[model samples]
Target: PICLLDTIGKVFEKVIATRLSAAIEAAGGLSPEQYGFRKGKSTLDAISKVVKTAEEACAGSRWRGGSKSYCLVVTLDIRNAFNSADWSRTLEALQRFNIPGYLQRIAPNTSMVGFADDVAIVVVAKHLAAAEELANAAVRAVESWLTVAGLDLAAQKTEAVLISSRKAVETASVQVGGTTIRSQRAIKYLGVLIDTRLSFKEHLEYVQRKASGTAGALSRMLLNTRGPKQATRKLLTSVVTSQILYAAPAWAKAAQVKTYMRGVEATYRLCALRIACSFRTVSDEAALVIAGQVPLRELIRERAEIHTAVPGRHPRGHGGRGAAGRQRPEPQEGTGAGRDSQPSDEAGTSADPKRGHGSVQQMPTRGYVPIEVEEATAPFAVQAGQAAG
Candidate 1:
């Protein structure tokens, strides 16, 4: 019984939902673990929480001298969750949360780590059996609640994964509604693919394949002399790159591996070459410079840093200024005594690459070159000298 609301009705519905959400938030009725549909929270936060918890559990087990560190993540899918919600139970839950009676009367309708309807139950233990027991208990609790609320659990669609070291990997089972969900090597949650070992190799491969297809299409359309202008092609490349780097903060650490970094860089370099309208023989560094793009590795690191800086934004508080109470170091003053002791211009300025206008810096041999270099360098070099002069 799905009812499609008219334009005016949809607007009215949004207004009411907004007010109700504001009230609930002001009342502190939601748990911190909830990240679905809440303002100022995102899927990245949920993903980060899962990753951090798993890593911490594994690390703790290692420190205690046990090779049995493991994490079990069970993702539940509710079929038609919102449409199947019982209004009476919803109002009752709201009442239990101490929501206003007047608001409850007005709300006959409406709807993560539990985003909207995607729920992931995570548990970690030193032993596989212990982890399975904990996961099963949590699943049963959620199933009970869903039953009481008149929602159907899509057992077939639900997935379970046991995250652990390769040497300690073992199989486990989770049951819901009399169906056993076996552990898989990987599971996709909120558009990111998470594997049993958290190596993110599969996810990276997935991104590479998708990005390569996009780059291939763009390459065809953005030919050297036949397609969109450089600006237009670059804009398209940026959109594709953003899609490729979605949820980077959660899995960026995997880029530390040489193989992973190379795979990502190769895909990104293809886009850069397309945007720059350069030959395939161009070096990755040169292509990125021509395309006016930073390396994917640096970009991912920057995104991770930014995510950490936002308070209550990251799942785990790493020395970030937000609520973590980490004091940011004060900027040092430029003392007159050491002004001349600074590194020579040839050594280059320490300006952040993100803030700088161009990737290329002036060097002794290179002198000052135009920030934007082209396939043919002679004319640009002459232009560079004129601009510098």
Candidate 2:
């Protein structure tokens, strides 16, 4: 009888759900910056904003307040974020924000502080020591606030990352409870690896490994099934590509990653050729034509544009490189990374005629005869690489 009554009671849940959400919003149950579980917003929005903030802070860390103020980002991993977010403590936090009400008011101490699971506290100060102290203060306050309300900080996972000028000789650490949190060169938050240098090399390598593994698995499937090449190609596009492109909108802003697009293109071309049983002499362009796969660089750029805020522009701050012009490292051989992709001042494409792999190749034209690049100079040829750098 109790089960039957429960089933019957749910019939009205639909009628009141909308009203319930509105009532909650009216009382400030959710902060504006919070996007989790909210309509018209996803975790990506939060991630993009956070990563952009990290980049800006990095720039400021290099040259803020007359060129000495660097920034520090301390990611606080509260063991069980949602499970531990006590209602009472949340209200107290609102009070700290002076969240416009008659009951209480306190000045907000942070420029950026909002997260349920992975909290990223952005501290931009003149010195590393000042930034470090600010970060620790947030932890202490939150730990005290949450502990009183039946939650505790996960000191084991909590760590700090300080980004300052390359030559800045400042180091700092934070302590939570008995746990003395140490600083790290790189830290993972929300599945993204952020380094103190913000190079994102680890992240690129991680995605490459994942995509490569998926591509290998797809290859195995091809051997077992007698299916059309289209099916295998679809699998590569949907699954393998997804693995490589996850969170690329924010991370791909690093120009050093541009060369990986070519690497990806090479991998796809090889996979397609094996299916067609094409000869080794076939060019990558021919293989891509056979597979109906879009150029990897184009694909990555399109996906990033779709998921992230403005591609090259920073979401905030005019002084920083923002996302588009963020970071471009000098291409060097032997690293197996991206090549020099500096574009001509006016032309959006890579200025140098050398295509994706950094190899100098003849750009085929209607009147021009086919010519192969000299083997000796092909591999090392760069697109005005040093002039741009």
Listed per candidate, the RMSD to the true structure in angstroms reads 19.4, 18.9
lDDT of 1: 0.62
Per TM-score, the best of the predicted structures is 1
- Residue-level lDDT tens digits of model 1 in 314-364: 423211222234332333576432323332221121211221111111111
Number of backbone-clashing residue pairs for each candidate, in the order shown: 1, 3
Full-model lDDT for every candidate: 0.62, 0.49
Q: What does candidate 1 score on TM? A: 0.73
For model 1, where is the 10-residue window of minimal lDDT? 361-370
For each candidate in turn, the TM-score is 0.73, 0.61
Residue 130 of candidate 1: its Cα lDDT? 64
